[model samples]
Target chain A: MYQYSNFDHEFVAQRVAQFRAQVARRLDGSLSEEEFKPLRLMNGLYLQLHAYMLRVAIPYGTLNGRQMDQLATIAERWDKDYGHFTTRQNIQFNWPKLEDVPDILQALADVEMHAIQTSGNTIRNVTADHFAGAAADEIADPRPIAELIRQWSTDHPEFQFLPRKFKIAVTGSPHDRAVTQAHDIGLRMTLQDGLRGFEVIVGGGLGRTPMIGKTLSPFVPLEDILPYLEAVVSTYNLLGRRDNKYKARIKITTHEHGIDDIKHRVETKFVKIKPLFTGEDMHILKEIERHFEPPNFKPAKPPVEAISTTSQPPAFRAWLDTNITPHKVPGYAIVSVSLKKPGATPGDASAAQMRALADIARDFGHDELRISNEQNVILPHVHRADLPQVYHALRQADLATANIGLISDIIACPGMDYCALATARSIPVAQQIATRFHALKLEHDIGPLKLKISGCVNACGHHHVGHIGILGLEKAGVESYQITLGGDAGEEAEIGTHAGPGFGADQIVPAIERLILGYLHLRANETESFLEAYRRLGLAPFKALLYPQEKKAA
Target chain B: MSVTPISKVVTANDLRSGEVIYLRFPHSWTPELSKASVITDDDLAQAGLAFAKGQANVVVGAYLSDVVAEIDGPKASHFRDTFRSTGPSNYRHGKQEI
Candidate 1:
């Protein structure tokens, strides 16, 4: 982990002190709610439906065991004894009081963390591929560049108040785990002519209007990448719509201005800003690279034969099949601890669960942990020999669900349950779907399906990119859900196309079960995933199965 | 003939604690929506909101929430208002715990 410098420590301390004073003023009637709203938002405090929600940024989704422990402490001591990990790879503490937020910020600062830019119209947490350095397919670790961007965009005077909140995602591998194509700015590290550069994708996002980003540049030289980003964001800052809040994103700007027009303007701006970056960023990256050096691997093979010979638990076998992935280093496996326990709230970790995970990171995981965008925790470097012990610990904590990419492994936003903007409840619906599927014991047979549920059109759950997407909406003052199919968040990314009418909240889970059951019958074999079946057969068969009664009525 | 408006109640989050609170009477708040006084007229609803606004020292985001007047008390007209009464269905916290 990159340790915070004295300058970084002092900067966060000063910010906390300033926000404490602001909170005091707001409470004393010195600052009106209207005035306090923006200030609170700047510090990542949102006035949610039930209480104050504090969104703390986990920069590039990287954390050490101590930081995880501190987060657990914050959850237990201040807010409710739980935290929600968001699709942006940040953690949100709901049910916090306004008076307690300053104290909470101080606790976060003690651990070199802050809630800064996790909300408001600022460059949010710069996310990276969770398995950045550990994955075998990656060319190089993407965190060094991501950390550099985090430093640059943290209260950058120029980009602080854009037309709307901007998001940036980075991935070093050809396999797009970061969902690079669905970001405001997506950077894919590529090698061209023996020189490393990025394939820049611009103006992709999911909200009221979903769009797949257009290629801004095939490759920009590594040295000039920052200048290129500045040019792109600057061009967007100038031309993005300010009149309509809904249309204020860079995606709309690119849509309205056309990619060619936007590209020409950005390149024109790039020429002017290219000279300002004077290799300081490269030096910072080298310094950051020192912190992310690979862990010394023990030369020991996993006891594969012994485990296979012994009567292993069916649940453990199921867990190994779904949750474990190949590591770049031999004898090591990346463990994805499922936060989506059956019938529980997705992405929520209790204080005890957090503590247990922290202990596991300290003991088994080289003190490094990652929060994946899929709302699960990643033990990035666990030894294969230690899997049984890790699994035992996780089972005790109720974090072992044995479902990684199955139907039960759903990504859901804190909809009307906690979010003020949500029109319907996402947690209950996700629970219903997961519990129902688990009861059926069909998830293992289903294989590699990504289901995402968003409470509203905000798409915070990354519902726009799920293989099967469920969006909750309010129709006729009752909770209604709309389903979409054929969405894929991969190297070849596409926004999901919506299926017909919205279903009642009660009708959605059974409808999804019907779609999946139809998919099984429609598939040539079990190896073909849900997305593959949907693509091969098209929506006609699935729709026919989903609403056979409706077809009969017609 | 004059038409009577739907019933309404003034509610806001307490400034100190973020608990959802309803205006039961002048300068008083209760967690129970049933204890809230309902205004059947638009002018009275506006007046109730203004009265709640004067108590800004203890509250924020004071506004009138639509409700239906029942024999027992005022009931929420929308599911959102119902959420304020029972808290989130996912967990037993806030007003739901009470």
Candidate 2:
């Protein structure tokens, strides 16, 4: 984890003090609601459907045990004893009173965390692959670059108010765990002639107009990333539309002016600015990289007798198979703690569960934790020898669900249930689908599947990237859900295709059941995943499954 | 022919606590929808909304929400308002806890 320097500490403290004064002014009637709204949003406080929600940034989704413990303390003290980890790899405290938000932000600052840039039109928190440093196939650790971007973009005066909110994601791995394709700017680290650089993709977004980002440059050397990025954002800042909020994102900007035109503009800008960078950014990057040095690894192996198939419970074996990922180190593993427990809210963790995870990270693994974009917690470097103990502790904490990439592991946004922007409730729909699948005991058999639900077209849940995507909308005062199939957020990213018509809230679960069970019969074999089957067979068969009556009539 | 006006109530979030609040008759706010003043008259509803918006120190984002007036009180016409009146379906927090 990157420790906060004196400057960083002073900056955060100053922000907290300013926000505290702003809150006091609002309460005392000196600042009107119109004046206070932008101020509050800038600090990541939102008056949602029910109460004020505070979104705290976990930059690059990295935190240590003490920080996690402090998050638990804040949740218990001021919030509703639980925090909702969002798709953006940030945590939101839903029930915080407006008066206590400044205090909550101060609590966050104490642990070197803040809600700054988690909202507003300013560049939001920079995200990277959750398994950045630990993943086996990574070209390099992406977090140092991500941290550098965070530092540069934090209060960059020129880029403070873009036409719309901008997001950037970086991945060191070719597998694309960070959904790079669906960001305003996506940096995939690559090597050319033994030199490290990034394949810069621009204009990809998942909201109303879903687009897979186009590559602006095949590769920009690591030394020039900052100036290159400045050019890209600067181009968008100048050209992006302000006439309509709906079409203000870089995706639309790049779309209106073709990728070639945008590329030309970016290159032209890059050429102008490249000369101004006198290597200070590189120096800062070097300093940031020092904080992210890998933890010391001990050579060890899992106790054969303890983890042997005959002695271990099937649940433990299942957990190992699903929740664990191979680490770069030989005797270590990446443990994904599932926040999507069966029938529960998808990404919510109670204060006790957060503490339990912190303890496990401090004791069994390295004193580090990661919040994945998939809305799961990661113990990024757990020794294989400590698997049994970690599994037992997780089971005690109710975090040991053996459904990492299964049907029950759904990503859902805070729909009408909690979000002011949502037209329909997504949580209840996700809960029903997960509960239904769990009851059938077919999730493992279903194989690796991504079922994502967004409350609205905002696509906060990344529904456009799911293998099976459900989008909820309001039609004539009734909640309706439309399903999309064959979406993938990996190396070969593609937007999902809609499967004709929509289902009511009451009918969506059974509609999904019909599709999945239909898929079981339609697949070439059990090994063929839902996405594979959908690809081979196309939408005709799946559309029939969802609407059998229409097929019967046809 | 005169069209039947949609019965509505003035709604906003309490500025201090950020709780969903409904404006009652004269000048008061309650968290309960049933306690809210349902105005069937269009002009009166707009006046209620204006009054709610004017109380900026106590409330934020005040607007009129469609409702159906029953013998007991007002029932939310839209599901979104019903959610605001009750709470999120996922948890028994907010107004639903009471």
Candidate 3:
């Protein structure tokens, strides 16, 4: 809900115009591919395995009906008739002509959107809780700060070429929905001394090397946020390893030098930079706050006509249990549209579906839309009175599959479909697993389960945080998968532990089914979720089912 | 090794409207490099920045270097260049000094 000021609008417009000319020059043989590569990356465009991929930032995963419609238009007109949402709260178009990219960017600017900083070594898209302002438990909206950071980091010359891609996440609530512990910089808004401040966690990341972040500053005052962040990032920029791309991330730096040492350095830097924080910055933050102020909210009781009377409308119950969450307002609910439907590509929405969702946002919802980190769409403020109508509309568009937090609600990257770095196909595997679980009707019976699949170590699929994580790899020209158990993406989050050995692509689906059966067999009745059972029973029982011969041999 | 097929890629910040010939593979473009072209300065430097003229079109324009057999629907091929085709073969970063 962050609105752009006239200055912000003009800045974005000027940028669009500047890039257009640059594109023209390159096509006219004035700029070579080498010369244009980094420039293009800054704009979140990548040439992957099949076509150009444009990653549009959903800064803190916030959008409105108009923005959604703009995305639909881009999908329909510029490239393929589909758009793929990503784990970083961004959307990617898998197929677009290089010649049309500038025009596509121009179109985005028309709607006050851009693909800026969605890629490259710069401060990538700043992500936060998708249910930021609307969540019932949030202390305050994180977007105002997220938007402030977006403005501060936009075209920021100082940190443009960092040692590696830097990510920042913000969570306003005690329950970290933004996955704060796994970002380069994680800001948790908390109350300190009866004043709102932040618990700054540093150097958390997932990829080839997974690390849980460390507390850099236990409590940083609200006024000192920008300066403090600048200190942290610039310090890392100076000290972070530049020799290896794999090791250059601040996570590695934090790991190598120790968080205490890093914190000391950042504190020293913050002291030096603290004076630069003028009232102007505070004024800007206040101005941005105006854009994010909750819309004129009317108090209403829960709609009497609608209540979840069905304790066992499996689909409805599943949705209520997983997809819908308690809103901050009465009689309103935040609806999460799961993209993990069987046989459907993760995070992909067709142009028509986008249009439908846009219409839904305008009519039933508060014209507010959010792209979730789990590769789903969100109707942030839907009235209880409009639930049935919204459900029916979503059902018509194939968006009403109510498996939100079940195993079917998987997070998968584009994998071999679009990413040049992918070793094997991930989306297909996610689809197969979802379809199988749906067919078995084991989703609800299994209780809340998160099955995340990533094409490679790059945790775009968010496999690092799933209750059951599947990582796709290539071995000798064949696709193979490794499974990890006990990962969680929520407040009590933990990265999963790998199961014994890898399974061939052919063996993965049946292997998953076997794992589920093992769960059912070992579970202490149906009351426990998959994560609880896994935590209680440990990997021994699941390993026994996966490799009986290996245990027998042992 | 057989010569791997290659395609041209351009960022959304580098594309313009109107009739423009571009190529695509079955799912995504090639690696960071490999038969890629900026074709325009904007395409090269458009990443992490906003589009100038249009809604930001990230695209690839290439003719199939080799005749690719279609394995999926529409005009796309499963053929890919090997790891040898890493980085921009004909391009380098920072070629455009400020």
Candidate 4:
């Protein structure tokens, strides 16, 4: 919801101009591919398996109607008819020509958005909780801090070419929807002695070697955060492994040196770094906060007749139950527009659906929309009275699935089906599982389950944090799926444990079904969710259920 | 299972259109794999890769990928390559549009 300043406007225009020139040079054969690759990558362009993928950043997962409309226009005009929203809260256009990227970036710049630092070994887009300002449990809005981080990290000379790609996530609420623990640097907003601060969790990331971030500084005051962060990153830049790309992340650095030694190094670096802070970031934070001011609330509630179980359609009722969550204001609610409709690819929105979402946001929800890390769209300030209209609009656009957090609401990355880095296909397996669950008619009964799949060990789908995680891999040149049990991305977060050996691609869906059905039998009652049930019984039950024949034979 | 020496072809994405293209001999790129230059010999395959890399201005990420020599043309040896040559399994888009 933050609007760009004049400086921001000028800066982005210049960056786009520079990229346009770079694109031209590359096209004219003035620059070699080796020379041009870094330039294109720095601008968020990658040549994937089939085509060039342009990842446009949606900073802190917030955007307005006009921006969304432009995104729709871009999807329709330049690339394919759809754009895939990623777990990083960015939208990826899969088929954009290298020549057209500059124009697309210019289009993005018009909306105060850019793909800068979206790729390459640089500070990436700063992510925040989707329900940042509106969530009832939030102590503060994390977006201002996220915006500050974005500004500081964007084109920062010191950390531009880090040993590895750096990621940072911010969460304002205690409930932890942002999965802060799974980022390179996770900052959970905290209040101590009536002062706003961050519980800085460092080194945690999910990839080839998944790690839960260790708490670096539990309560660094908001004013000192920048310097503290610089120290941490500077320490990492020097000490992080440059020898192997695989072992280059800050997590590996922490793993090698241990958190205590890393902390000592950070503290030593902080002494030199702290004096450089001139309180300019505070002014910037204030400016950013001004842009994020909440809309005036008019009190109203859902119609009594609408809530009547007897009169309402069960599907609509189910949708209301699953998709609606309480807003900070009494009469307002956060409506999650589900992208996971049955067999549809997760997080993929057609241009028409994007336009429809834009219109709905503009007309009904104060022109505010959020892309959740869970790969769903959020109308964060929808009045309770507008629920029926919103739902109607969403239904018309094929956006209403009633499967948010259900079995069918799977978060899957564009795996081998699209990604050059992917080892196996994720989308097909996700579609099959969702379709199977829909056919079984048990998702609503199963309730509040999270299923996530990633193409490879790169945890783009947040598979490590899912209640049930499926990782697709290539084994002997054939697709095999690995299952993990009992991961949760919440206040109480844990990486799911590997259940057993992998299943064949064809075997994955049935294996998931068996696991869920087994979960149903193992649960003390229906109220206990899959994660809760798994916590009670441990991995053995789920593991046995997933591969029953093998378990039985063993 | 024992394997024999298989044919191979060079491929890259066309720079302007971002379409998957196979290297055809005498300096050309084509979406149709059937028209691609099939390298039965290992030395020629490496030569094809070198030639493909030279078409940098027209394409990007050029490399040699395994293919099964067919009467018509070379076919993708791996499923991943097949998906790349074709399009996604979940959707009919890209080269699979026809």
Estimate candidate 4's RMSD in Å.
1.6
DockQ of 2: 0.91
| Count of clashes, each model | 0, 0, 70, 0
lDDT of 1 by residue, A209-306 (tens): 99988899999988888889999999999999999999999999999999999999999999999888888888888898898888777776656445
RMSD of 3: 8.4
Task: Please give the RMSD to the true structure for each candidate, in Å.
Answer: 1.3, 1.2, 8.4, 1.6
The top-ranked prediction according to TM-score is 2
TM-score of chain B of 3: 0.19
Judged by whole-model lDDT over C-alpha atoms, candidate 4 comes out at 0.90
> A191-262, model 4: which lDDT tens digit per residue?
999999999999989999999999998999999999999999999999999999999999999999999999
- Label model 3 with its docking quality class: incorrect
Error of 3 at A467 (Å): 1.1
TM-score of 4: 0.98
TM-score of every model versus the real structure: 0.98, 0.99, 0.86, 0.98
Which segments of candidate 4 are over 4 A away from where they belong?
A301-309, B1-4
TM-score leaderboard ranking? 2, 1, 4, 3
What DockQ, on C-alphas, does every prediction get?
0.82, 0.91, 0.06, 0.79
The reply for model 2, stretches above 4 Å from the true place, is: A301-308, B1-4
lDDT of each: 0.90, 0.94, 0.78, 0.90
Residues A6-35 of candidate 3: C-alpha lDDT, one tens digit per residue: 887898888777777777776776776667
Model 3, position A476: C-alpha lDDT score:
65
